[model samples]
Target: MRGQTQTASAGGRWRGDGAAAWCWWWVAVVLLLGHLPSCARAGLLESNPGLAYNFYKNSCPSVDSIVRSVTWAQVAANPALPARLLRLHFHDCFVKGCDASILLDTAQSEKTAAPNLSVGGYEVIDAIKAQLERACPGVVSCADIVALAARDAVSYQFKASLWQVETGRRDGTVSLASNTGALPSPFAGFAGLLQSFSDRGLNLTDLVALSGAHTIGVASCSSVTPRLYQGNASSVDPLLDSAYARTLMSSCPNPSPASATVALDGGTPFRFDSGYYTRVQQRQGTLASDAALAQNAAAAQMVADLTNPIKFYAAFSMSMKKMGRVDVLTGANGQIRKQCRQVNTS
Candidate 1:
């Protein structure tokens, strides 16, 4: 009986020891997991993997649909809107990442810059924000909204071509006109354009691809006059189609501080097609920057390659995705302002 009791006690002790050992093993696992990279965790508690696709999947299910709805309405009302909104996003990202810094209303802001002066569509963004705030206040960041609006507007323009956007971006508090001096200018040469894109984490391919945005926008005479009056001696920047030059000079006989508006794509200005690539290849590119692509040996190949609708569309989508990532602040690192035009009072 004594031996049996002792045996039973030993069995119980062994069982307890085994259970404790298992508990300790789990604790070790928890501790190790706690130290993994921020993205490895699965919660909104932190912004690991920084921005993600459909980040508002659970928090705000209607976010994307809402953006598309608002964008489509604006575009429907004004077919010119997609280009304007797309330009707004590009200008925003170039200045200080896609932080909605461009959306901020302030004296002496980036909006004061010459390139940004013509950028419209502020009311559209405001309208979208107002609706989002109504649906899910503080759940979506203005930065993410701007990024999505750009994607949605482009997808709306090019229904056959689309790409996913990674969210989680936080709004920035700073917007300055002075910081934009480094941005690629209409007057930039290939070297300057290459550097400008590189500074913002883009490449030669990206430069040509994103320039496709010009396919649907208008270029002022001021942007084109130089290519004629002050243009390359090699017959209108050597890349411009001769007949197009005559047509441009006819409209822009004299340089105005702001020249007459002409479509970047000579004939099909409103269409978001590979027509811009075709123009560049024919030396009919409107801006010095667009024509410069043909001037660069390597970029010329990309220019030629993108002339194919399939290639240009794919490359353009990829480049836009890459551009969205410039100097972004993700996760809890930045604030989500109630108003995109102003930082939170806190």
Candidate 2:
């Protein structure tokens, strides 16, 4: 039987040795395609770049929420802290793409309250660093982490589907306390905001677009009362509807700094949309920064442009990209923090 089998295999159909050789050759090809060029594929999925992005995508929301919550607490802890964070958000986004440099208190002013003010999200970033270190240490930059955090907070609060921004920005090591004037004041008229954003190399379109941020957050009566009471005229031009304004005044009151500001859209404050523009058209914009946009020739055009959802959506994304590019503090210049409210507490 063995002789017959050997004869058949050698002479015709069953060439076991030949079949084995073919199998090994195909296996080699498969292995090469799957595993070759480790360096070239290093940044691909399962590689460092992929992993870093995944880390940001997965980790950003919790980190952002934690950081934001801490900031709120800090604000609660001290009246100055919330104002600083709000101002920081305004300054950072307006200047260098919201890099949080406006929140830092450096050597410039030890005595000046405004300059020395810092609502440190760096501490939150530091905590994130330690945790990420436990999982994949030294792979993520604090800039990227915080940028993702900010974006996540916006997306989450607005109830938009996850809006992921590009990461990989390095944390800034130094702080600039003197640049606080860069942000627009809640009291500033349309022209003031336009000029401030323009100085930062941003356009009136950006000023209008970013003002939509007021949709999701609450404001103090001290900030909005002027508009509710008599109207800034230059800012709240045409004036808000008397009935609506009166209703708003009832809720906000006069003189109380702690009274809450009304939402711009009145409904769905958390959703990012063109409703903000529509509200401005209706004189329903709540903040001076928001209502003021409609008074400018350039910003008015932007507000009109945003009345079209398609255009507003497109312009909003572009504006966000531009806003994110403002004065980013990066590279050996920033510190990775263990907490969001303090500088490197860990």
Candidate 3:
């Protein structure tokens, strides 16, 4: 099995011996996570999340249920809301910590950035914030709302949620479009993805796992076209499945100005399942970033483990918990805003 190639059609899946390597480490991952509390394992305790899991228990008892209920209803209505909210969280965390900076509406806020133009669900975050204000005004932070709403969006729809967000994050007073360059690009390769994750103090495990969030989101046609036609079959990255490339080209033959979108996962685009990893393993990944997971030894090995729906679901939960902790604001650092789109009157 060492150095052997196995095509998905052959039922072996994942080229080389990655599958064999994946089998051994899969158990260790599960066992390691099972024994470690989420805070320690996700590194929330070390890099971020100075607050406790019960931070809002006494101050705002209904915060959890209210956010989940509102997010679930919105997702049920649109089905695409989860992915949008998830992207919002990623964009927020990548810039200025997870301080709700992405939610600001200033003339030069992160939302106005070129990379963040497609990110939506401002209304969802606002609605959740409004509900929280009525229930416990001036208590809950807008930053925490983004985190909770992201968790609820994916968990409620797919039942694949794994971690609870620790609260006490504050709203950042600054939001700049320039900060977005650190965020991962849809066209990034394996090295680019690694650096992007590493910039946020995340490791390869977090990169592979959190990337599964693409399982439920949509990518614009512009992002997809470059992957399909930038090069010929030989010149293009061999990781992409040929038939799948042809299929993608058919959907996005020409770049139109009207604005179009397609699911990042392509297979089970609306569900938060292990399908994304499998698609990546089979070279059917829709984005350059999605398909790049197989290019690295470490990431590909994890991809092999995550091919199983159960394993992928568990691993994804762990990674997401860690991703939410990237560069957070705790202690007396930031402020809670009355509205998510603006900082409180200081």
Task: Find the candidate with the highest lDDT and give its number.
Answer: 3
* lDDT at residue 22 of model 3 (Cα atoms): 52
By TM-score, the candidates rank as 3, 1, 2
Model 3 clashes, total count: 0
lDDT of 2 at 105: 47
Candidate 2 local accuracy as lDDT?
0.51
Better of 2 and 3 by lDDT: 3
Residue 226 Cα positional deviation in candidate 1, in Å, after optimal superposition: 1.9
Candidate 2 RMSD to the correct structure: 20.1
**Candidate 3: tens digits of C-alpha lDDT, residues 179-204:** 88888888888998899889888889
Cα-based TM-score, every candidate: 0.82, 0.62, 0.86
RMSD in angstroms between candidate 3 and the native structure over all alpha carbons? 8.5
**What's the C-alpha lDDT at position 336 in model 2?**
51
After superposing candidate 2, which stretches have Cα over 4 Å from the reference?
1-90, 95-97, 102-130, 157-164, 176-178, 230-238, 257-259, 331-346
Candidate 1 error regions (>4 Å): 1-49, 158-161, 231-238, 257-259
Whole-model Cα lDDT of every candidate shown, in order: 0.76, 0.51, 0.78
Residue 146 CA displacement from its true place in model 2, Å: 2.7
